[model samples]
Target: MNRSAAPLVRELQPGEIGPAAAGLVLDALAARRDPVIGVATGSSPSPLYAALSASGADFSRAAWFALDEYVGLPAGHPQSYAEVLRREIIEPLGLDPQAVHLPDPHREDLQKACDEYERSIAAAGGIDLQILGIGRNGHLAFNEPGGALDSRTRVEILTEDTRRANQRFFDSLDSVPTRCLTQGLGTILDAGQLLLIARGQDKAEALRAALRGPVSPECPASVLQLHGRLTVLADPAAASLL
Candidate 1:
């Protein structure tokens, strides 16, 4: 264990997600002239992204990276993580799409691409801030529980729970991707700071486990207890159990 304390849980009032997130972004930008940020997919971080997008934040010099991407989806697919990010965050912020890094699992040379992406992140001076969301099964990004906590960016078969939760992205539940490419625990730890965001009642148990449970792969987000600077942000529903 890294000897760091558990994440500081706080209850967010209605509509406070935006200001809270904007404050974090402002803090990051002020701390680093060109911050390297890691972004996650799904509905949890949407409010935060929206707030940052409208903050008039100048990201021209900043570099952005995603936590994961579906393996079989085309880059242009509406459900693709890349597309979701572009539609919700990158485009709205007027960021150079070229500067935004997304894992291209569609490539046959996925291993090579993963290595290259890691190299690019390292070369850009590692991440100053990494935003995150917890899955129903306590997964972070696509680093699902039962998998090795020390793992790195690579392909993974999505768990059934994950698929069910994300089924809306597809025409039918069957259309949801079975696999993904996600940054490893090592990659997430390389960041100087990390922010894990959550909301809703569905996240309560997972949030409680992450806060009170042991550091085990059974609850992957528990790994944050080892990081030096990790901030867990959650709304009242998500904070209920905590």
Candidate 2:
């Protein structure tokens, strides 16, 4: 695939990010008869979700797909990506639970579960737009550093840095799952459009690398530049390095 020179990067105020992102979603909804949205869970996307919730938009026809989920968590675990999406996206937007899809992390046959997730996405006609949040270490979804660029939906081992960053969502650091099922770089890039959001100074370096550095697995998000249609939204602090 021919890589774009760079993604369209826009640095805006913290408050401005939400409405700006909402505009994009609203435009997409107006254009597509059936919209498939790829959802990301993290602080960076919280504002966008809030904006959508308040926009009085009708999302009944949309289908939501989570980007990743923690492995070995009991069903309905509060911190699971399923619950997070429920609390953040589904309930607030009044979306049907049946319209939202998440990978089954509790399955005994995880590889089959992953394959099924991929097939489900394909059956839905692939994602129209994918919302993304960058890890401090530049990981996309759970496709951590050192993962293959052409990877698909599968299991991935969490890096210590990633685990540490996510420990706040769990009772303790040890409670954070070491493994996750995630849509890999190849899977995410399949979307018709990609929208990445980042915030805070902690993300400055990662955002810089993803936007300006070489497309290397060491900074998984750098793969975004290889995408034909990608837009990055970041707060001034997060975009400082760029």
Each prediction's whole-model lDDT (CA): 0.84, 0.93
Judged by whole-model lDDT over C-alpha atoms, candidate 2 comes out at 0.93
Q: What TM-score would every model get versus the actual structure? A: 0.96, 0.98
The deviation in Å at residue 211 for candidate 2 is 0.9
Instruction: Name the regions of candidate 1 deviating beyond 4 angstroms.
Output: none
Off by over 4 Å in 2: none
- For 29-126, candidate 1 gives per-residue lDDT tens digits of 78887788888878888888788887886778888999999888765889988888889888888989988898778788888878887888889899
